[model samples]
Target: MDLGTCDDSGLETGSDAFLALRIRIETHIATIGIIGLGYVGLPLAQAIVERGYPVLGLDVDTTKVETLNRGETYIRHITAETVAAMGATGRFSATVDFDRLAECDLILICVPTPLNRYREPDLSYVEETTRAIAARLRRGQLIVLESTTYPGTTAQLMAPILEAGGLRSGSDFFLAYSPEREDPGNPQYSTAAIPKVVGGEGPEALELARLFYASIVAQAIPVSSSATAEAVKLTENIFRAVNIALVNELKVIYDAMGIDVWEVIDAAKTKPFGFMPFYPGPGLGGHCIPIDPFYLTWKAREFEINTRFIELAGEVNTRMPHWVVERLALALDQRLGRGLSRARVLLLGMAYKKNVGDLRESPSLRLMEMMEGRGAHVDYHDPYIPEVMRTREHPSLAGRRSIAWNLASIAEYDAVLIATDHDGLDYEGMVGAAKLVVDTRNVCARHGVSGANVVKA
Candidate 1:
C-alpha cells in the first residue's frame, strides 16, 4: 500500500553491463517503465512505486495521461488518491510520449491484445508498443511484455521488433514475457499479491526478469520459455471458459429436469475433492474469460490442432442469453399466463461482474437485445453503471441510460431479470413489485426467494 517513489537510474548500465544493472536493481536504483496505463499497467505502476522504484508510465491515450498528470485516476479500483500520492513524489508520471523509453532500465508492456471483429488475435497495440520501444531501443535494458496474447508473441512478434534496432536480444539487451494476472474488483488480491509467471528469451534474461518481479510481487515463477508463460495464461482462462460453459450447459439440462443448478452446485461442492464450482450465469462475461481463451484457439490452428472444447464453450456461452430469454417467456406463461411478447422486462445489472462497471462481453447487453427480439420491452437498472457508453463490442446500446429504481418504477416492468448479482440492491422490493421475476445468476435464491413468484434460468 505504501508505494514509495524514487526516480533516476544509477551509474551506467553500460559499465560492466549485467553486473551493474543487477546491482542497481538490487539497490533500487533501476527505473521501471510501463506502457499502456489501463487496468493492468496502472495498478502495476502503483505496486512498483510502493516497492520504491521510480516509474515512467506511457500510454497513447491523452485523457489518461492528463488525468494522471492532474493527480487522478480513471479506473474504478485504482483511486485518485493513489495516483495523486504517486505523482506528488515527482517520480511517477504517465504520458503519451514514447520517447522516454530510453530513460528506463526496465520497461514492461501491458497493452491490450483484444480480438478483432472476426475474433482473431488483434496484436495491434502490442505491435505498436513494441515498435515504439524499438525506435528508442538501447543496450543494457530489459524489455518484458506483460500483454496477454497468443503463445510465441514475445519471441515471434516483439523480439524481432526490438532486435530490429541492431541490438541483439540476449547479448546486448534482455527480453522476457510475463503474463498479466489482474482481477479487477477482487479485494482479496492485488498486483503485489498475485504470483507472476515470467519466462525470458535466455537464462540471464530469465534471472533478471524473475528478480524484478520478485522485488515487487509475492512470488515470481520462472517457466521454460516465453511461449510456455503465454500458454500458462491462455490455459488458466480456457479452463475457466470451458468449465463455465459446462456449468451453463448443465444449467439448461437441470432446468428441464426441474432441478436448480445452483442447489446442485451447492450439494456437489460438499464433496470438496474433485469439484470446483463455476456458477452458471446469463453468460460468460469479463475481459479475460470471454476473450483470452480465443488467443489459444487462434494459435492452435497454426499447429493443426483443433480446439473443439474452446469452440464448444464459446458456443454454449453465447447461446445462454437466448436460452435465458426463453426461460423468461416460459416463466411468464407459467405464472401470469402472459407471453414475453409486449411484456415489460427490467434487467438488474449491466456489468460483467458484481460491483464493477466494466461491461466488456457482459451477457446483460446480449440478454437485453435478445429479450427485445422476443418482443419484450427491456430497460436496465445497474447501480454500478448509470450511463451507457458506446463500446466497440456493443455500439447498438448507445444513448440508453439507467432507469431510476423505485417500487412504483419496479412495478411497471412485467418481469425482472437478474443478470449480475451485485450486492446492496433492493431485490426484496423488486420481487414484491414485479409480477414475474427471472433470476439468471441465482441471486434470488441467495436472497431467500422461491415458490411460483420467481423463476431460475
Candidate 2:
C-alpha cells in the first residue's frame, strides 16, 4: 500500500514541455488516446469523453473498433446507448491505427498481460504495444500503462524500449503506470467512481499522470514509482486470490463434515468488525484473481525466493473445478444411481461471474473439459454469453451455444450443475425440474429454492 501524496502544487512550473502539457491538461484540451477497446478501455474512454476531453481510441481488433464506431457495444454493462452518446458528442472515435499515437497528448495502454503455457508471465501484449508506441513516439506525450503486471515492468521493460529512440523519459516524454480497476457488471463501482493509483518514472511524470486521472476519476492516488504502482495492482488481486482460495478449501472441508459452508459464512460475516467475507465458488475466475497472483510468484524467483503461500493458494484454487466435478459425480450416482459416464449434464452460467458476458479465464471451461474428459455429455446455459468464443486455452469449446432455458430442456438433462449464481435465473424452476442438482454456488439455498434433489457442493 505505497500510497504517495497527491499534492501537485509547484510542479506546474517546470520546463517548457511540462508547462505546455500542464496547460493542455488544465484546459481539458489534451487528446487522450486509449489502446485496447475491450472491458477496461471502452468505459475509460467514455469517462474521459464525458469530462470534455477529446478521446482517440486505439485497438488492434477491427471488430471492436467497427462496433464502437457504429455506436454499438460488445460488452453487456456498457450499453449501445452509451457508445451512441459518445459518438454524438463528437469527441470520441475508435480506430485500429498505431500511427495515430502521435496525435494523442496522453496515451493509456490497456492491453492484456496473460500467462504463458508454463504459467509464467507473458508480456507479449505489453511489449508489442510499447514497440508500436515507440515507433511513433514524439515530444509532449504522456504515456501511461494501465495493464496489470509485476513490479518493475514499466521501468525495466517499457521505459528502455520507449527510450530506445533517443528520448529521455522525464524530459523528452513522460512515462507512468496506472493500473486499471474495472469491475464489469458491478453497478456500485463504475470507471469514474473508483480511485486510480498512479506511479511515475519521475516527479513530473507522476504529477502529470495524477492530474490527468484526477480529472476523470473520483481520486488519483500517487505512489513512489512505477514499480510500486504495478505492485499495488498485483497486491490487490493477490489478496483476493488468497482469500478466495481459503474459502474454496473451507467449502470442501465443510462439505465432508456435513456442514453448510455458505451458512457458516453467513453467520461469520454478521460480526461488525474483524471479518470481511469472501465467498467460495467452483473456482476463481475473471482476468485477475486466478492469474494475477502468479505474476508475483514468477517475479519472486528472480530474488531466489519462492512464493510458497501464494503458490499454495493458486494450487487450491486451480483444483476447485476438479473438486466440483467429483461432487457432481457423487451426487449423480447417489440421487440418480448413475455415474457421469453417458450422463447428460446441464451447466448453468458460462461467464466468469454473474450478469457479465466476459469469459476471460472462466473456471467453467475447466469444469466442462473435466466432465467431458470423464465421458459425460455437457451443455451450457448463459444469458450473457450466447456462444463460446475462441479462447487461447479452450479453442475446441468455441462456437458452443448455450442451451435454451426452460423446464423441458433442464428436465432432459440427467443432472444440473450451478457454477455461477447469476441474478434473475429461474432457480426454483431448476430445482423442481432437474432430477439431480449439484450447487457449487449455493445459489439454490440463497434463493430459498432447495429440494431433496439439490446437493450443495
RMSD for each of the candidates: 5.1, 3.3
Cα error, candidate 1, residue 190 (Å): 1.3
With a 3 Å backbone cut-off (N, CA, C), the pairs that clash in candidate 1 are: 3-50
Instruction: Indicate which candidate wins on TM-score.
Output: 2
Q: Candidate 1: minimum summed lDDT over ten consecutive residues — where?
A: 6-15
Candidate 2 TM-score over all chains jointly = 0.98
Model 1 TM-score, 2 decimals? 0.94
Q: Who wins the lDDT comparison?
A: 2
Residues 306-357, model 2: lDDT tens digits = 9999999999999999899999988888888998997999999899999999
Candidate 1 C-alpha lDDT tens digits along 1-457: 1224322332123334455567778998899999989888999999999899999999888998999999987787888899999988877988788888999999999887888999999999889888899999887899999988888998998888889868898768889999999998898998899999999998767878988999999999999999999999998999999999999999999888988889899999999699998899988887788899889888989999999879999999989988988888988887878888879988999998998878878888888888887788889998878877787877889878889888898887788989999988877877888888888888877988664678888
